[model samples]
Target: MEFYLKENGVRTQLEYGELDISGNEDYGYRPFQLMIASIAGCSASVFRKILTKKKIEIEDLHITAEAERDAEHANKITKISLHFIVKGENLDKGKLEKSLELAKKNCTMVQSVKGSIEVVETLELINLSN
Candidate 1:
């Protein structure tokens, strides 16, 4: 939530703990990296919660996230894609879709960037018992 200037071109991000996120990539994580991570992490967990509450049993869940940045000034992220791979017995595509919709709607990070960023979701439902 806060940042400290360590030295020229060097800084640290502060929140629950201190992390080096300097302007120089050699030092630590970049701001954009953290942003996408926050988005992916928040939505991933939110989806888990929603599915659990809906009594959907799953063996595993994996997510891959990516972002696209604008070419103009600011070069901010314009779109984000979240791909979910769910492994389970008798996974309901309809229920899974509904859960993802709810997660996208409710995730705090997603909601925060709702107006500025376009978020996309995809899923691969794998039935191990098949």
Candidate 2:
């Protein structure tokens, strides 16, 4: 991917559209935000695949990511916490926990930053059948 330098940030043309990346949020997406998104997106996708393979029916899946950045060290991301809110009918917590473990093991983004960044995953299940 090639990026062109813009007045405030850099812009890259992707298949979907143009991507703008900058340190300033006013201009474009911040690097850290993209990183967190990548991690969370990867994890959620993998988890959903696992659930589907297990024949688990779900109504909705949502993920929230929180990151811890160190100000003294170039504001690098030190840790990331991912919270998954799963809404479904008669969902099994045990199966969801196991699926999450598989997701963390298989997710490319999570594995890529394994040694460097601490990743924490948590889950909340809402059963519509209740």
Candidate 3:
């Protein structure tokens, strides 16, 4: 589980695998993608963990992520939005909302972003077999 990164004008990677992330200027995920993936992945993990504890069975989970960048000398991410779609059986809105709230409270990834990150979550119960 190791990756080698080099800063050659643009970041580059030397190795990657299922257990590790490797990248290069042309083959690696952009720094921005890493940031976005962190938030999205962490939120989903937290949401699922909390909900599962409350007996909420998730059939599907999807997240839509968007970010706005500053248009100045140091153009960086200014705001990020995460739209969550949760599908399950007998999903409880209160529990679903609570899971999201708890995720927001405990997700280190979201906390690390250090800016205004808005999350919009929707819960839908679907029959996956159908």
Candidates 1 and 2, the one with greater lDDT: 2
Question: Model 1, 1-130: lDDT tens per residue?
Answer: 5556776444554566668775567877788888889999999999999998999999999999999999795889999999999999989899999999999999999999998989899999998878
lDDT by residue for model 2 over 10-109, one digit each (tens)? 9999999999999999999999999999999999999999999999999999998999999999999999999999999999999999999999999999
Q: What alpha-carbon RMSD in Å does predicted model 3 have with respect to the real structure?
A: 4.3
Ranking by TM-score: 2, 1, 3
Candidate 1's error at 103, in angstroms?
Answer: 0.5
Q: Candidate 2: minimum summed lDDT over ten consecutive residues — where?
A: 56-65
Tell me the tens digit of each residue's lDDT in model 3 across 79-129.
Answer: 668878776666666777777888887889887755654544444545354
Give the local distance difference test score of model 1.
0.89
Residue 112 of model 3 has an lDDT of 72
Which of candidates 1 and 2 reaches a greater TM-score?
Answer: 2
- 63, model 3: CA deviation in Å? 0.6
The positional error of residue 88 in candidate 3, measured at the CA in angstroms, is 1.8
TM for candidate 2 is: 0.98
